[model samples]
Target: MSIAPARIDEQTIRALPKAEVHVHLEGTFSLIDLLTLAKENGVALPGPAATLFDISTHTDFETPEVTTGGGTGTGSAGLSGFLRFLDWQCGLVRTPEQAARVAYAFAARQSASGVRYSDVIVNPTHWNAWRGRDLALMDALSAGFDEAEQDGLCRVGIAYSLLRGQTAADAEDAVARLADASLRRVVALSVDGDEKTTGRTGEKFQNAFAIAASAGLHRTVHAGESSGPEGVWDAIDLLQAERIDHGVRAIEDDALIARLIADGVSLGVCPRSNITLGIYDGWASHPLPRLLAAGVRVTLNTDDPAPMGTSLEADWAVAADQFGFSHDDMVGFARRSLEASFADDDLKRDLLTELEAVVTASTAAEVTA
Candidate 1:
């Protein structure tokens, strides 16, 4: 008789303390939620909401320049096409009430998935409701986060993301507004979008990031996903990014890999999202294992959980099945995420302690079994 391996269960994955640092708020809404929003706001519902969220339908999302010949460009479809979808999804929210609902729900979902902490990124420009009113949007979003924290769901902080195509002047203005807002729940500043389509480099926004850093704000940048190793270099050398979201392409350059390891920078790797976005063919081809072996601090995340049809639990399972990460390795990934977060030291310590206890208990149970 053949022996079968035990299957990973929710109980097993949920028992581990997880932290997410690269999720996007716009991409979190479900088809049902979008439909509800449309009905409530009197906005015409888009047809086949299911197709909108399906990555298979948008195979052209990743442009040929980056996906083939290892060329360097935004890895996704041209700006007009991808942005059309992104903007359509983002346009669903026309009021603070909708924003708050999404934020609170996201926290609850993450809590149930064993994510103890997260730093959710949202690009304010995408929302017409937040046009020329960044503070209002921040306040509304923060209120939602506050409720979630009080309810003991999960601790979440907002990372205000700058769109990639924004001018230097626009970047400075946004950062200044962020500093002035000084929202308690807002923890970091980030830049996200298609780097290849925008033709913008990290150097373009160095001064804006500098201003944010001077304000004691944490920084992360989207790099090496759609672009190449040089994009990662610019993020580290020019923008002084503390973390690189979807930096799988960093494996292309030995010097960049060494630098990331030496500097203790974290790479928030999203496995499913990379494949869905055409950055990689599959998890096996992803740079995560290489990055890990090269001593880079790697943390698994769900970049666009809903759109990519992934959750923290799902990502963790994939990492274990594909990467062959042991239980201890999963725990290490969680621990590093908490450490890399913008969360306070006390929270980090508490979460770390809880994770240690989980490991101990799991080990004891295994021994007994």
Candidate 2:
């Protein structure tokens, strides 16, 4: 006979101390902050400030494009609409002050959602061109990181991204900048941008990855997000990445799955982003559960909170409601993320112990209740 389904309460889910292993820092800018920064920077947006964050209208997932005359541009329709929203984001945050504000707001939001630590991916390429000040962008980013950390809301880490379409020299420069920033303990070096723009395999990014690795920075790549499992392999073999972002397609390759598990490489999984982008039909069909069952270490995150209409808590809720992940399973995911994180040994151990206590205590309390 079939067994009864497990019961998951929202309180238990929310009470689980969690950590975000992948998130785009700029992508986390709340609608209110975005509009405020836009107004201050004199950038013209399509609608009133209030409408920018309106979940109902904005949630109608459409493809993103550069709009003129208040009309959406034609493009690959999907969660990319949210990515298009980010294209317009540069104009709004053109100063160091704005960047710090974005960081603060993002940390506050994550803390409220039960996140104890977060690794925020920041694309300096966008900010460098937008600010055009020749100032130390990495220094400015460190300032933001410091402010977020000082808030005591969460332990914050930064990942610098190299754009895929950039020239080899440009990629080298991005890596050099990241290497210099690594002196201050930025977490990892990431490669992002349009996969098609760089031919998916990203031959030019190798030198950048090499430089980052030489500087003792961990490496991750936005692989298998737009391409297939082969893209994930290229990132592993070609770039020597220590982790992968949106590696859902890895399930398609038995050899790759075995290699990933054997090597202990982690996959930063974003469930809602997958659903919004049509990578998976829904949470239940998402490969995350399968990946986890197969012994692949996976961590959940909100790729773009505003555009994707999700938060850390909401993503966890989906894992419960759709994937049937128990509260224990969700806590296990968080603990694994801390262990697999790019954080230093001391911090990782400390956070792991804290999370274990939280999980153990919460589980006992649930049993008593």
TM-scores of the models, in the order given: 0.91, 0.88
Model 1 Cα lDDT, one tens digit per residue, 53-97: 654355332111211111112544533444444556566776888
lDDT of 1 at 83: 49
lDDT of 2 at 112: 85
Q: Residue by residue across 186-270, what tens digits does model 2's lDDT show? A: 7788877655434564577888889988998889888876667888898998898889887888999999999899888899888
Model 1: lDDT of residue 307:
62
Give residue 256's lDDT in candidate 1 (0 to 100): 91
Whole-model Cα lDDT per candidate?
Answer: 0.79, 0.71
Best candidate, lDDT-wise? 1
Which pairs of residues collide in model 1?
61-76, 61-77, 62-76, 63-76, 74-196
**Cα lDDT for residue 240, candidate 1:** 88
TM-score of 2: 0.88
